[model samples]
Each structure stands twice: as C-alpha cells, then as structure tokens.
Target: METSDKVIHAIYNDDDVLMAAVKTVKAKRFHIEEIYTPFPVHGLDKAMGLAPTRIAIAAFMYGCVGLTVATIMMNFIMIEDWPQNIGGKPSFSYLENMPAFVPIMFELTVFFAAHLMVITFYLRSRMWPFKKAENPDPRTTDDHFLMEIPVNHGNERELHDLLSKTGAVEINVVNNTH
Candidate 1:
C-alpha cells in the first residue's frame, strides 16, 4: 500500500471522451495510472497500448487435459473393468467403441475449459471472496469514468489544464497514500 502525494483524478462523462483523453495524454508522454469505467469500452485496451491476453492458450491446454482424462476414464470403464455387451456387441476394444465416447469427450473438454478459465481469471484479477473494493470514486461504478494520472512536481497546473481541455467534467487532486 505505497502512496503518492500527487495523484490527479480526471472524471469524464462519456467513454468516447475518455478514449480521446487517453490518446492525448499518451501523445503528451504522460503516464496514466489507471482508468475506471462503469461498462466495458471496446478498443480501450488498444488505445492504452496494453499487451494482448494469453487466456486462449491456457483454455486450450485445459481442454486438452480434459479430453485426455475423458478418454482414459471411458476406456477403463467400457473396455477393462467390466465388459458390457449391447445388441450382441462386446465392448472388447476401446478404438472400436470410440464413437460412443465422442459426446463425453466433447462435454468434458468444454466443461474443463470453461470452469478453469473462469477460475484462472478470478485468481489473476485478485477477486477472491471478501476482498475490499479498490475503486477510488463510487460514481465510477455507476456512470462516471475516472482517469488517474500521477502528477510530477510543478506540473499539476499543466496537467489540470490539459485534462480540462480534454472534456473532463471534474478534476480532483488527491493524496493517494494507501
């Protein structure tokens, strides 16, 4: 919980304005701490120049694990432990009965990929139970959008003026010592 004595919060009324402000701030070579919006804004990450996510690779690996488990379990149950005969057909070979296991494999693959991806996202975001909210302004959760910027010494006025020009509805300089 380190702190900064000079942090400015520039509040915006719309996402479009916020996006433009972000681009302007970046063009001016100012470091943006974070932005809070009530809803997801498309292309915001690209505007911020953040790297692409790798969640899809993780989901694929999880699906592979699920498929392997399903195949092994089905093979053992249908061909090894107790061989069952259906319609004068004996369950003696796993490869021959692979068609019957396709549905189970597909279901388990989807289930594992979905469940594990959700759990991974929650953990990665530090969204555990009973965690306190980190939003600085309550209004950001409802309708307002807040952009946080670190103010260097002697540049607070310039930053405020720039934010105002970028269509910020309100600006507050906060001592973020937390």
Candidate 2:
C-alpha cells in the first residue's frame, strides 16, 4: 500500500472491537494501511480483503522436491555408489530395498516443506535482515490493537468520527517520517 504523508492511527483495546472497526472502515470505503495486534486475530486476513495466500502450494512443491532428493540420494548411496552387505541383503537394488528408505523420505519431505515455507514467507513479507519495524505504536505490541489508515486531505474528521463510533479507545493523526 502506498501511504500518504498524513495517516490516522486508531487504537482499540479489544479484538472484537477492532474487527468491528475494520469492517466499518471498509464499509465506508476507507483503505486500511495496516493493523498491528499483540496476537493473531482469526479471520482478520479475510476481513481485510487480503487475497488468500498460495504458500501451501509452494510448501507442497518443496515437499515434492525434498522427496525426490531423498530418493535420489538414497538410491545412489545404497544401490549404485556403494552397496553394503548388511543383513544378507547385498542386492544393490533400490526397488528391492525401498521399504528401508521410507523413514528417510518422510523426514526429508517434512524438513524441506517446513523450513522452506518459513523462508518463503519471510521473503514474501519483505522482512529481510535489519528491516525497520512498521509498528506505529508501542501499545500495539502489548495489550492494544492499532489500525493505520492513509489520510486523505479532507477525511480526517470523518475518519475520526467513524473510528469513535466503532469503539476505538484512542485516535491520532500523525505525519509519517519517511
């Protein structure tokens, strides 16, 4: 979102109130820049009109890659590269010994899916190393919820009234530093 110079910060004490405020603001056709909450609020993403994320698809693909890698590595190590003579099973054939590789394949799939999903989410969020925090108020990190909206030239009063009607505990208009 490309925020303007001036913005409105509406702080709410309750998550339910915050949710109502969000719906109210969107009903009034105001664009919400962001919302900061101490914890995740269920259904907040849907309420914000945010597009459903496709990260699960990425995770499944990554899991497939991991499974492939595990299969190839196990095949090369046990069958082709160095065939071991353990338990009278020196066939040097992957198909014959496929049962023994099940645990490895499962672990690799879970590992790749979980780790890569986290990295992908971090990168997709543009949250690289040493990035400045976007939280506008410290109270939001504690027990409050903060909603930020880009302020148009003549919408301050209207926005303020709207927030107050929606149970916002405090509101402020501030100019952005950057």
lDDT of 1: 0.91
Backbone clash count for every predicted candidate, in the order shown:
0, 0
Model 2 regions lying over 4 Å from their true place: 1-3
Best by TM-score: 2
**Per-residue alpha-carbon lDDT of model 1 for 1-178, expressed as tens digits?**
3345779999999999999999999899888888999999999888888889999999999999999989999989889998899777659899888888899999999999999999999999999999999999999999999999887766899999999999999999998744
Worst 10 residues of 1 by lDDT: 1-10
Which lDDT tens digits does candidate 2 get at residues 52-80? Answer: 99998999999999999999999998888
* lDDT (Cα, 0-100) at 53 in candidate 2: 93
In candidate 2 the C-alpha lDDT for residue 98 amounts to: 84
| List of clashing residue pairs for candidate 2 | none
**Deviating ranges (above 4 Å) for candidate 1:** 1-3, 87-89
lDDT of 1 at 51: 89
TM match of model 1 to true structure: 0.91
